[model samples]
Target: MSGTTWAAIDLHHHVVPREYAKALSKLGVTEGLGVQLPKWEASKALDVMDAHGIARSVVSISAPGVYFPAKDPTSAVAKQLSRAMNEACAALVRDHPGRFGVFATLPVPDVDAALEELRYAFDELH
Candidate 1:
């Protein structure tokens, strides 16, 4: 299974810094139970890939895709979450090389943050 190949991009994942995840946890989102969905770890993601024979995964922001405001108290927290998560994504790609890719998660609903993140992600990261 590990040797087998399939294109994949588990972009809609979350393995952010603990504090950030906890803050998100406080927001409390779930399908039905109302329990906060636990953060998704990169190792768990990779392990799943190993099990499923997925060759690679492009990690990116899922829904809530940074609709969080970039101002307020939560704004900094949101920005930190966004930055930390994106950095984590990059690190995952770095660790896995060709097996992984990452898309920047901007603190959005904020056009300024989106454009800023875009410039940074494309210009600097590229």
Candidate 2:
């Protein structure tokens, strides 16, 4: 090892943008099913990296990140929310290059929709 001191990459981080926050911020937000986020200040995330000597992070979406109010969890609305969340995440990483990476979200219980989202995230978004 060259003994270079750089911040380690944290592969798991969440930023509940308006898209993910919207569902969680519903009329009756509660525990268990409620949307939750750490004190997701970007500065704070970076601060941890600085304190821990980590230079980068590869972020991922945790479970129950975003929910759909529709009857079917595999509804188009869910897909839309997923897409929006992905977009926002991409933007965040783009805005802060060399510091963050994306861990995309897909409206699960919907395979086709997830595939489409993958295409969009990798292809169109790229």
Candidate 3:
């Protein structure tokens, strides 16, 4: 490997935007995948990043993602969740300067919504 040093980049960092967390709580998703959702805040995340010497973190919604009520075939809720999540992440990046980046959530399995989000994310959110 080329010996080089650059500030660390955390590629798979998860960010629970405030509204998203509230939405999840309302949905009764206290825990899943054998783990309760931990509290997260921008200040707390920055602290963790500093402790780990991470110069930047690319944030996105983690597992279980924006989808909800597995029975819904229309994926209507997922689209809304993805939009809010992406907007929040974009706001963080805009406000925090160099501390964070975004992966841009998409309402997946929904081709039309995903395409719209992809276009909006790159063209507008960035």
Candidate 4:
């Protein structure tokens, strides 16, 4: 494999958008899936990717997802959160060009809203 160059793609990457974190904090959610939430920053992620020789990473929100236990799964708040997160991911992609891609967030349990967000993510964001 001498002189070979590899462009790696990381499919399982997680991102905690700033706004999403704040929203979760406001809702008194400081952790997810029995672990403390990670503080994700784009510069740090990029540095790690460079060290790992990763050319691109497709990122999504981690556990606890978009549904808050205190709020109904079908609540508008979930939809709003999903939209905000997806938009944030899209921004990352836009800002980083080939370095980042988004695994769009959806408001699950709210079928209609999820579908709407899916369409928006693919059509508008992409």
Among the numbered candidates, top TM-score falls to: 4
Candidate 3 residue spans exceeding 4 A from truth: 1-5, 69-71
Counting only residues 3 or more apart in sequence or on different chains, how many pairs clash (N, Cα, C under 3 Å) in candidate 4?
Answer: 0
At residue 111, what lDDT does model 3 achieve? 85
**lDDT accuracy of residue 50 in candidate 4:** 98
Worst 10 residues of 1 by lDDT: 29-38
Clashing pairs in model 1, backbone N/Cα/C closer than 3 A: 9-58, 11-60
Candidate 4 residues 1-126, lDDT tens each?
Answer: 999998899999999888988988877887888898999999999999999999999999987788874665447778888999999999999999999988889888778889999999999998
Write model 1 residue lDDT over 38-80, tens digit each, in one string.
5667678778888877777766654444344433445665566
Put down candidate 3 lDDT per residue, 20-101, tens digits, no spaces.
8787777677654667776779999999999989999999876667777564468887888888898999999988999899
Q: Tell me the tens digit of each residue's lDDT in model 2 across 1-126.
A: 598755466777656554555565562443233444433567777777878878788776554555554544447666877788788778878887888888777767677888898899898666
Q: Worst lDDT window (10 residues) for model 2? A: 27-36
Per-model clash counts, in order, read 2, 5, 0, 0
What's the CA error at residue 45 for candidate 2, in Å?
1.3
Model 4: pairs clashing at backbone N, Cα or C within 3 Å: none
TM-score of each: 0.67, 0.78, 0.89, 0.93
Model 1 Cα RMSD, 1 decimal: 4.7
What overall lDDT, based on C-alpha atoms, would model 1 receive against the true structure?
Answer: 0.62
